[model samples]
Target chain A: MATTENGPGALEPRPAPPKEQRFSLNAIQELEEIASHYPERKAACLPALWIAQREYGGYLTPAAIQEVADRLGMSYAEVEGVATFYTMYNLRPRGRHHLEVCTCLTCAVMGAYDVVHELERALGIEVGGTTRDGEFTLSEVECLDYCGAATVVQVGDRYFTHVTADNVLNLIEELRQSEEYTPVKLADAIVKLHLPGSSQTGGGSRTGEQIRNNELY
Target chain B: MGIRNLLFEHRDVENIQDIAVYEKHGGYRGLKKAVKMERSAVIEEIKTSGLRGRGGAGFPTGIKWSGIPQNDDKPHYIICNADEGEPGTYKDRELMLKLPHLLVEGMIIAGYALRGTAGYIYIRGEYVEPAWQVRKAIDQAYRAGYLGKNILGVKGFNFDLYIHMGAGSYECGEESALMSSLMGERGQPRLKFPHAPYPTVEGVWKSPTLINNVETFCAAAKILDMGGAEYARLGTERSKGTKIFSVSGHVARPANYEVEMGTPLMELIEAAGGVVGGALKAVIPGGSSVQIVRAEDCPRVNLDYESCQQNGTLLGSGGFMVFNDRTDIVLLMKRTAEFYMHESCGKCTPCREGTRWIYKILDRITSGGGQPGDVELLLDICSQIDGRSYCGLGDAAAWPIVGAIKAFREEFDYWIAHKRSPVGPGHVPPTPEVVNPLLTLVPA
Candidate 1:
């Protein structure tokens, strides 16, 4: 079946994991805290996937899914199914500064097409393809609930609203340089990576240890 | 008669999320007032206020609370539907980002009324800032004694709220799907039998749960403070209270506007700083799922449920997507259909296949391969998908094609006749300046 080249990389099969590793101590600690909030262990599925997406660079890997499944006492297929069902859980890899342009009704009409086209032209790839420098991958997604900010371009955790085609290139360069992301990481900037609950109660848990950043996951 | 701004009253005020600032401006006053009131009285107030769910389905909020069985053995849950993913909607995002306490306060009151011990704000993953702000507000509320084991030192009334993130399934905005996603499963909507329990009766963990919109919860708190009867006086007969419309696209000033219900459709557009280039082509009165009406026929339309329904469109999630004369109807319909097609959970056959088929046909026609009978086929497919699929999404997949063809069949037919849209590429418009904070301008 020929997939429409509309949204970048939707129909393409997700890449297989290169290797496997257990969740880091901090990730386990965070997952345990999140798991405590729910009545069932499975309810922590989205949160676990979020941690994996952050720990791994911008995508989920099969190994990470298995680790999450193991932690939640669910089958790999079950976790994978839950992970793949969500659009935010990227099965394949995304670039360093993953950029998504909202191309739904509001943004599409409000210059989203132009934004995507410009991003593609600037990056020298179509919507689904990634840049050779591994800096950006442009994809058009559904609404982000920021419709008023038409042509809403989401990069990591930041939403750059109302970006036109004319300024998108500059916007990309700016976003690539944009700092501070979500999905709690291990570092001195632990405030950005502070897991909910009492992981930072003592003010001494800033181990400055980075989570293993597997590029290919 | 005029714009009514309740939810967005302090939208532009800095540090509104800070508990001190919010309370100083009467933030938790509703929660404080409701806490001392009897549990039944809180529910009674919401019932009297006539506040309907601001989520797509205009279900009465007070009546929804009345459905939950209080003495049920299982503990009750209160889920805040913060996953505002409907195309052309962003009002909840602002409410959560700017005024997070309103949601927290609303949840506390609603949970207290239903005897719900736990609450969750199921926010969409794409909403990075709103979610963070909400989490911070939750912490603030906990520290301020507005939440937790004994709020205001009131015993036997325990309500704990947590913020959860959804990866990205637009269907999760639906209560059942949201529960499924919450319980670590694929977010698919369950079939509802008449006698069978709803989320309020048999929801997550098979317990009675109440899910309300961010705006609904905020309005609940506001209703409690303003007194139910006073709140009921606003809006039309059925649609009460001021609604926050996320006005976007083809407008000089596209932003969130809170207007009294039953405001004329043209008036809301004017409130959003009027049409760009001083011309209007069409208006999607609601979100993408509702009908798309032409600008020529919009004056008869009002920003209420009854008026939109009378005009052959429903005021479903006031995500107003306005289009100007420079826009292309074919492309809009195509994109709208394409969205539902992509978001379909594939649980049902009709919607799963029908949406894609309709999109492909539109794709062919819009790309200049349109043959005769394509429009009829699209309409036929839309009818098949509508009312046939299990959930509202399946029915929603039909609206884009049905509404577009209904209002602008000739324009769609024009694409088929010409084998291409008259409005083509290289005609990308400029972005309207997005105001950082959507506040109504008060002339000094």
Candidate 2:
């Protein structure tokens, strides 16, 4: 039978979801601060949902969605709808390191197809499957917004571009074993710090060398 | 043509987001001049410069700005479409990450032109570093009197700007979709054409709005600084000024390069340190959505709006992605189909279902399944989804698939005929009977 937990027919005040119970005081403060950025509290739906997902361990659970709704003054349905919309937000639990490999046109043409296959083979899991050891989850994503470095494989927030079957495993091993992230050559460049004075846009400079060197302070 | 490093210059400088470093390289010059110039004068100057929208549409920026109702009682809003979610496009990322002031100064000028009391730069959520840089620049602008009360210390010239990060949604890059997201709604494209209440006429709480791409606004700042007529002299008749192309894929150096609009596409490829390994076979002159130009026809393709359009492609977002002869065309087509399907937003039935349908068929072909008439079916499906969807996302999904099939039907057919996966090192035919549940086109 369809219950009020899944429907609007229930009468009692809905119990707090698991995420709400697990929500740290700090996360609530962060959500409140983020809510203030929008003119309407509802406008913080995306940000609020993101916080809930992060706190709940890299995925959005039913509890997390309900918690967001309660905090944002939204219905359970409204919160659920936005949370499930974007590909970035995980609806289910992910592995410790969620690897999102870009399979868009550029990345695919540059052999991202092989990259996905290699990841699947090495991890012994298909795309969208979690590894048996619970260390990794592989997904074929759209874009990491860095097309120049095609075939971007994002491990959590870190992006590994120009990945191939050869070096991608080295990268995974590095991520698994290393203390600090020591990237393969291409990925190393992707994480290069965007220092002062040098920027991609400004001052009619296309060679990107106009402000190449400037005082740090 | 040599590198015309206009906006892309000084991208790597340390502390590039600092107001002082930005000012060192003639930053805020356009905003300073814009404060002096009358509002209409700023709009008119942009019009004369012939700056077109950089966010794939190639719409004229001046004409779009002129559409805002100045006498309306409703508050006007100026939105910067920094929510760049296109698969192969990252020029906007380069701009926001490096030159925060360029976008901020551009927003101030555009805000002045549109007479918008408040402004918002709707950036995508995944851009953690860019958002931090943008907020830093906005804070710097407020302190320098470029934003907030009395911009540039002029009396009654109060203006405020804020950066709003979007939760990852590709459709949010659409103008109406962006507005919907900004208003705390689902990022779905509002039906405007053949309907009333365009964004310029009524947007963001039913008020007049002037929304533009990050690159377009940045260009506007430059056009104002340089004489409009002089800026007009840079490119072809229809398209003017330099365009930033984020060249990646099979290239030695995949970086963002801004070139004059009419530069040949091959030159842009060379500027990206040329294609890696074998000879160049195909090129997506714009981002992934536009029609793909085969290698032979690529040289004739100019890096401008009309020229690319004439050549059966587009200068979309200038996200130039190259592929060498060794690359698999069919796999590329499949991957492209997968992107559109995932990002369809599920608002329009045709886009939602049609992209899925195409992806299903492409999966079938790539999974070593063959049908005699699959290519025709793919093209037919594209026709159904192209103009019928509610928004550009569907059209974008349709174009590249149709273009790929039209350009390289043989490669697709080979995969089907031989039941081979064109991916791996050699002609690796599927040794295992891999059944994709989505592929259901076999004539049992």
Candidate 3:
């Protein structure tokens, strides 16, 4: 599947999904609310898809694309065209855990190439290729623009920087072994900033006081 | 650091922002010279010199000038794109704040070269001081007979200048979107096809117009004065002339450096204080949209468009952001993705939906939601958004998310597996609010 260098595959672009499959009622209501922010319905496509992709998983199943189109009052083709154009909208099923490596110039210069190769070796899949166990899929992408730190990778919503091949290998093994890990609370994570007047000091510290604790915001 | 002398030698009587100070420093000399030359000669000179646009695209400025229809009947508009919104980008603001007349002079030269009578400088609203400086300069120019009607006794070529403000949309940085905003419409990009049309043939009001970046216009005066060959000698073969790079991130000195194109990257880092005493992890050679270059990748990379393209990154606006050893790729993804998601114009589906989808995947992965198949899912989503969006914004928005995953998968794997950042997550960093809402609050 990855034999081709780049560009579209041999198959013609697929027809858009049917109207009913575009979205569910629950998502439609939310999209309508997002549409209110912009005068043009087209402008809501991004925000709507953000919510829709969350509801539909990694890929924008044909039905999900159609639903976004229907909600935005745009044609299925327009919606499909947009979905297929960007690298973010997934068109296929993916593993339960996704890993993003920053190959932007900065990361690449910082031995990101080796990090990518390490993941491929660990998962037995090429960049942009999925693993047989559906546990990890890896791909190369542009800069995350966190030039303050290189060798950065994003897993889920969190960012990990200053990474190496060894760091990645161990991390992958830990993830595969740990089934009890759960997401940290956003509010708790956010509260660790220790605002000047705020009373919370050690009240909400999660584990290691990291970037979330720094009040860059 | 006090007025680099080349651009400020004569203009340092006081501050260039004031008309009196600028006039004392031979401010309108370029305009004066420009008024005497035929428009054809000015355009020819620029084209021959091979000066390119300074606003990242690096398209030859003279060719753009020549693209305008010479015999067009419609009124031509000339605009200066001053909406410098790229994060880690601030060179335009520095130019405007220190050398307002340089910009005005550049605009005059560009207007003459393009035969435009009506011109505007679209200033970003957030930059109040620079906007004020430009406004003052234009008023000064009008008073000194540099703008409006015939200038310096040049007959039949009248010029008028105006200042237009943008409503804080990064999309406006795109040329088409900038045109839409200039026309009082929402700042959304239009379809670009065929040979990039000369703006003068079909620009603002569907008439012939020439829209140039602030830096591009400013470079015009210098290029005309030096001639094309002299100007070409400064930069590399393909990328001619000096480029103003906005240096930021983990460095001792985070300021703008105007250097000849193709200068080595390691030199820039060293000049900026050599990574601030920490491990040099990565470097963003261009604005946030360009691919990130890892520290090891910096040896051969030069600060020019051709070099960047050859190296798989781009010299996008020269907005360099540096990262150190402490930075987390996942945090970078979330922050950048969140920015794209917030700023997404929702014009096309790929960018609109794709941005958010990646953000969610990154969010879940970083938040300790380690599913077995998450990585494959992420790669698949990125492939869908790569070339499918309607505008570059979609591609711009998606690059950081996908790139982070590509270069730093292990960090992500660690977060998913450990339920904490692989670097040791405790609390998320707080984002800074640059604009003060309280400043707008008036006492009752």
Candidate 4:
């Protein structure tokens, strides 16, 4: 048998066997209802992945992908291809808070890189790394499309706007104290947005009052 | 002209997102009117309005709506492309967030005009907050009989609207890629006209589908509410009605301004309280994909489609980004390149590979490794990628760099010769520390 290489592209350790089905009864129901909206079952693959991401706690493990594929009656490879294609879907576990800093054109000219550098210094992690304490994961994102508020940072479902190098650390301090806007919460919010009456049921971090009040940024 | 509120006429109304409040402001009167008129007559009103698409391409909205075969029993579908991912654009986000019922009314109107089955609003996944408002609006519409069977009590006229959220892919903003993603595939562009049939002919499970931008749909609603001729009277001769410009970056008041089509570009800057922080350096009249015009040339440009083309740029998606004197043009181009590189769907080779080359070259120039011929090399690479790819992403990737070079060749030359920005240190996007230390170990 050929020996495995030790560096990049090396494959040595085998993955553990797939875990038990993680989709809860509620998740299954949500998946079926969303699927009914589409003409074909395959059309539910994206929403099914969202349900999987929430059920698997914010990241899509192999088992999670398998469950989505099985539920949608899609090949695992087809489902995995979609899971990896999207930037929002987490393939690996992330820190509780995922701080996506917009560093696109307008934000770049508005000192977004400075905010990224500040977050990197404050958290002691590079762009893609999670904090050792598991509090935050910092990554520079392309435009979050809220260029009116340059240097927009998205955590969970909420977009914190007008973030500057001067104020980013303060925002970090605030995020540190808050339990809302976590990755799981982001997934939960997304999954709920697809379901009807989710607004009245008070899904996601924003309350019906906040949405009604036009307080959302 | 200054701000002319058509779609935003009732924007400041309290609880506008609520169905009762929206109806109080004369919402859904368009759907009610559209449902009463003959379907052909409804499309005729849209054609009379001369509304072009607001989603970058300035295609006539009325023409696009009329493209679907009439009296078809093939289960027509309507898609509202709400995946607003253009860098400097956020008008759709605001529309969906503040006026969710407006969009719902627009789609319902289109469903009535197109004799549609159901409508799906393909909103980007990050817009969970906006999507919630839309979901609530759809539910409320259903309850009010504004949606579902015999909408507004029109017998045999049925329409259902649903929200389909994209999972963070900018390519999905493109209509075909959006349809593909809706069918639960990887978000990549399919072949366009001449190679493949139009989405209106065969889309979403091979059923006849009509896909339009969120703004286009909203404008349709307004067109029906006001008679089409009245709506057409506001804008330029060609680009009709008002366009919402998301003005940001170095402006004192960064917000969306809905102005008539032929407004002076500089007046828009003035409308946004003029340039702040420093004197205006340049303006990306459209989103990042369109060409940038220097401040000296901005006076000649108008915020209309044809006038923008005359000035060598486009009124794309109305992402009006302004930059100031402290900004470095070369560094800005590099960051722009980085965005296209990251967002390229990789289905086509020119976009997939050319975007990376552009980023690497721009990165090299900014990192003190630019050779004498690097600028020429950048232009040549851009030329290869501009029109050779499967979709506009490649062309979009190529335009700004070419436009930047055409407008500011000296800046690129100065950076190449001095191995630093001509605008000097302390640029807005300062040179970042090498995130991957290993990249530094590579020989320049």
Which candidate ranks first by lDDT, i.e. highest?
4
DockQ scores for all predicted structures: 0.30, 0.28, 0.02, 0.51
In Å, residue B213's CA in model 1 sits off its true spot by: 0.8
Backbone clashes in model 3:
117
Better of 3 and 4 by DockQ: 4
- Model 3: CA > 4 A from native: A1-217, B1-13, B23-26, B195-198, B425-444
Give each model a TM-score. Answer: 0.90, 0.87, 0.64, 0.95
Q: After superposition, how far is residue A215 of candidate 1 from its true place, in Å?
A: 32
User: Across residues B1-444, which tens digit of lDDT does each residue of candidate 2 receive?
Assistant: 446877777677666778898888888998888889888998999999999999999889999999997776667788999899887788888788689889988888988888887788888866655665676678777777787777786676767776666766888998988988887678898888667677888888788888899998888878878868888988888888899888877789888888988898888888889888778989988887889889999889888888898899988887788888777777677767877877788898999999999988887877767688999999999999999988899999999998988788778878888877555564221221222222211111
- In model 1, what is the error at residue B101, expressed in angstroms? 0.1
Kindly list the per-residue Cα lDDT of model 4 for residues B247-351, writing each as its tens digit. 999999998899998999999999999999888999998999999999999999988999999999999999999999888999899888888888899899999
- DockQ, candidate no. 3: 0.02
Candidate 4 lDDT over A5-97, as tens digits, reads 566677756553375698999988999889999999999999898888888888998999988888888888899899989988898888889
Given candidate 4, what's the lDDT at residue A182?
Answer: 83
Could you tell me the lDDT of residue B26 within candidate 1?
86
- lDDT per residue for candidate 1 within B1-444, as digits (tens), equals 557888778766667777798898888888888888988888999999988889989999998998889777788999999889888888898787678888999999987888887998888877756666677778778888888887888887888888778877899997888888888899998867564677777888988889999999999989988999999899889888888888988788887889999999999888888898547988987798998998889999988889899999988898898887778788777777778878888889998899789878877887778989998898888889888887889898898678888888887788888865565543323221221111111100
RMSD (CA, Å), candidate 2 to true, equals 6.1
> Where does model 1 exceed 4 Å of error?
A1-19, A176-217, B422-444
Candidate 4 runs further than 4 Å off: A1-19, A204-217, B434-444
Candidate 1 lDDT at A145 equals 75
DockQ pick, better of 1 and 2: 1
Question: Which RMSD does model 1 reach against the true structure?
Answer: 8.8
Q: lDDT of each prediction vs. the true structure?
A: 0.77, 0.75, 0.65, 0.88
